[model samples]
Target chain A: MSTNPANHSTPVNTAAGKLAVGWALVGVPLAYGVYETLTRVAALFG
Target chain B: MGFLDRERTIAPAGFNRWLVPPAALAVHLCIGQAYATSVYKTALVKHFGASLTEIGLIFSIAIVMLGLSAAIMGTWVDRNGPRKAMFTSAMFWTGGFLIGSLGIFTHQLWLVYLGYGVVGGIGLGIGYISPVSTLIKWFPDRPGLATGMAIMGFGGGALIASPVSTALLKAYDPNSGAQGWVASGDAVGKLFLTLAVAYLVYMLFGAFTIKVPADGWRPAGFDPATVKAAKLVTTENVSARNAVKTPQFWLVWVALFCNVTAGIGILEQAAPMIQDFFRTSDGASAVSAAVAAGFVGLLSIGNMAGRFAWSATSDITGRKRIYMLYLGVGAVLYTVLALAGSSTTILYVALAFLIISFYGGGFATVPAYLRDLFGTFQVGAIHGRLLTAWSAAGVAGPLIVNAFLDAQGKPGQLTAASYQPALLTMVALLVVGFVANLLVKPVSARFHEPRPDRERPHEPAMEA
Candidate 1:
């Protein structure tokens, strides 16, 4: 999938690409955090 | 130019990035000390003859307030910037300790709660988010590592506080009735005063040291769109208000709540749980019990280390892959903990530490992830809203673990073995998290709105 061309200029090899990669790196653990949180709530309901 | 503008315009060369983490560490390490509340549980119970419920409330109130304060202060931090936020955080945090010292001296439980839980919790919330958004903007090329470095301090904060609190408690030895036998009240008061002074100094360092990145400062040779195209996550900018309205927000909420609840089951009661497990069959002594408390501190070390190491590692491996490792491997480790049933101390401790690391890693990595999905536009505010998950986990994790323990008839009794039910319940939670992680499809294209002309020159809509 291509990123919206309007929001970003220059290709993936540009500074924007590095910034996106940086954000994704942080996002991994973030996704887990959300997972961790929801399951804890589920435990209470059960 | 204003300090914010001046700071942003001048990028330091070489060792500049090093300053941000330590500044962040000062606050995190201080508030992370909350992890050591278990160290004081016995003190509160012994001194005030407080009930288990009352003791739990102290910590719970603090955590709940932490979330509330963060939600309120986040927008202010965005508008005013980290310096003002950190300055305010330092004042409240240090002042809370001072006030708490008075509460302990006067034997007023309500005062203690007000001081530490409400006042201090606000400090924690402000201090916690102060550096996060700025760090992401500053190190846009390495958001994961940059934020991880600062956040790891928060995880480690408890590691530092646990040993310090233990040492101070021993030094005071209120029972000795000697020169050092300060009344428990006096000792607690003095401790708070000392911590108050120290935190003020440390937090001031953070406030003064913080700097935002200049506008239009992209990393050398990096393209944003190409990277967004490769990742299945969102690249759209969504306001915190709009972000909460989407399904994606709730999905992430579920995921965090599960992971934290599973970890806190072991964390909130680590020392007593270990001792009880050991004593039921073998009858460990008081000294051994004290040693178990140290294990809690060790877990803090693991938690802190993982926040930095794993999150930073995610920068290279991809966030999805690291999370897969956390949920998949975490489930296996938790299962081993359940089956092991305290047979080998080594297995129990090792497994607990690993799980805590994943827990801490989850926290350290999420803001960056939010930035990825929602864009940096109102990420600090969005992140604050997301922290409601932590507040929920704070209540849920302890309730599940403690309720099960309470149902089993308190730790020292013969029926304490019934904690196996809670452990099994945690394992089930992990499985649910694993499913949620799997269900997380990339952010939908519908969520990506067109950028305003002010943000960029005319361009086509991005693909998903």
Candidate 2:
């Protein structure tokens, strides 16, 4: 059973990369939405 | 078709569990667009030459469809994996937008109802539950946190879509952003087309990326026994069919219905109610319209934040104890608001924020509670059936508030005293929910599947 080191690392690396990008895809928009909402929310006191 | 199968979606060893939350978020955020229809509502009313009631029916129909479809398709969603369910949801959702756009272009209201209301509503129902079971399975140790992150996206979805929809309308018609401006029907049609295409891509990404945990997978160093150690938490499996037969199901239903009802009492009337509460002797409101709008926005923040924060907190506090806070303390908060809310703005805002957060918390916490009571065997389906409570509350909450207000005076002219009756009614409802929560006990043995152990490992090839 020949297990290449690079092949073993590839799935792990891909999984890590996917995690970051996936969170960013949802997180960036949610952050923007929150920022906009906060700006309006600030007006409640102002 | 093969790619979307439950067997195909089973995760390989070492797949990152963190990736699944975003996948759930993608579908939720897209379906969350349902909340942003108000941005273009006036335009639709103007274009269709319909009454406000008629225009609003579009939203009403969609909500009804959401509850109905979720109840109908829940078991189906559980049988299939998240991948197929998410994909089907994406297709129906985008298809609704496309059909709705066509209706707008052709000037037909029924088509709009069929497209966005019935079809899009089904999308909402399926999409809402699609990722929940998967997220629960992935993080059985922290089911509250896992489900909270996904459900919070549903709340946050409106936040993103409202601004984006406004921007799209502004881009289409520069005057749409001006004071009291309504975009043209053509612009809204174009907006629908754009959203359908964009959401299709986004939801497709979510569907493809989502993977179920491999059979018997558990997070590192996590013990399943610890979860069942709590009094209410169970290691038993109850099929969705049997779950409905149990009194525990209806008790949770009452708790959810009351929580949602009280929250809607504040949400539905936040803008006008704030102004009404602070109105001067001669009918002038000390709170400006802009400030009232901001107050509504603040409540929205409370609503969204509560969904995530309170739900995650349940992971530590335990689900039943959290519901005690939501329903029991919720009743107390309503009492104070009804009694003294008129005295100060700060008191009113603070109390309303807390109540609404409990409302959101109730929503986010129920799935985990169901997981505790019913087990994960059909938690998604049970949760789906549970959402019918939301639909009932939606109608009842507004009716209760409005009926009392109508007895007092017209809109834009009422006072805080006028709202006291309704507010007190909510307090009573919350008490009922609190009692229901108190009465909740374990499901009887007969409801459990006949298997030796309820926490059966996933057999991907097994039929329901």
Instruction: Show where candidate 1 strays beyond 4 Å.
Output: A1-46, B1-15, B39-41, B45-49, B166-183, B278-287, B341-343, B414-417, B454-464
TM-scores for the candidates: 0.81, 0.96
Query: Which digits, one per residue and each the tens of the lDDT, describe model 2 over residues B118-149?
Result: 99999999999999999999999999998889
Query: How many backbone overlaps does candidate 1 show?
Result: 37
Clashes of each: 37, 0
Candidate 2 wrong stretches, greater than 4 Å: A1-9, B177-179, B452-464
Interface RMSD of each: 11.2, 2.2
lDDT of 2 at B247: 97
Candidate 2, position B99, lDDT = 96
lDDT per residue (tens digit) for residues B1-464 in model 1: 26543344344332244455556666676777676676567667666778967976877888898888887777777777777778888988888888777888888888889998889889888888888888887766677898888888777565556556666766676564456342365666677787788778777766776666556666667677755764644556766666776676777777778888988888887767767766534554322644664676566667777889888887777666677677778888988887775677667778888999999888888787778777887788877888888999988998898788787784566223567888888888878877776676665554555666544233423332
